[model samples]
Target: MLSYIYALAGQFQLTHERLSDMPAAPPVLLSDRQTEVLKWAAAGKSRGVTADIMNISEAAVDDHFRRIFKKLNCNDKVVAVLRAMSSGIIHL
Candidate 1:
């Protein structure tokens, strides 16, 4: 499972690198904790599991994802993870 995630991330990186000729989008800044949460999400962790691993409440985790969604202009966790990976915001 983890290897599959890594492979997907690798593909995103490769695709982005191949598009280097295009003008790059403005860098999207995320807090350290937000990045950490997205990393766990990229690892296929559930919200409760991510909260437990981070020693934060599930509500906190949800809040982080909400902010992440807004920042990434995404509405779903999977989309947010893909955007983050494509933008080199997080790695597997």
Candidate 2:
């Protein structure tokens, strides 16, 4: 069971080097709201928690993540945050 779980998890893992290997695009410009959402996401907050903290709907939080992902050219939140920080787009 544990091996199966590990294999399943491995299928979804994204390494930092893999993310870095993506084309060196220009720094992505994010809206203020999207920046805030990215910060919350980096802190390991769930969509519902981020929504509450920002006083917005969960759907809005999801939308923000969608836009963030597109803007950052990353498929996952971790990669997006890493790229943002490395590109000087966000401090944290």
Tell me, by TM-score, which candidate is best.
Answer: 1
Total clashes in model 1, counting residue pairs 3 or more apart in sequence or in different chains? 0
lDDT of 1 by residue, 38-73 (tens): 999888899999999999999999999999999987
Worst 10-residue lDDT window, candidate 1: 6-15
Off by over 4 Å in 1: 1-24
Q: Tell me, what's the RMSD of every candidate?
A: 4.3, 5.1
Question: All candidates' lDDT scores?
Answer: 0.85, 0.77
Which pairs clash in model 1? none
Q: What are the clash counts of all predictions, listed in order? A: 0, 0
| lDDT by residue for model 2 (3-90), tens | 4564344334434444566655775889999999988977879989999999999999889989998987666777677777766777
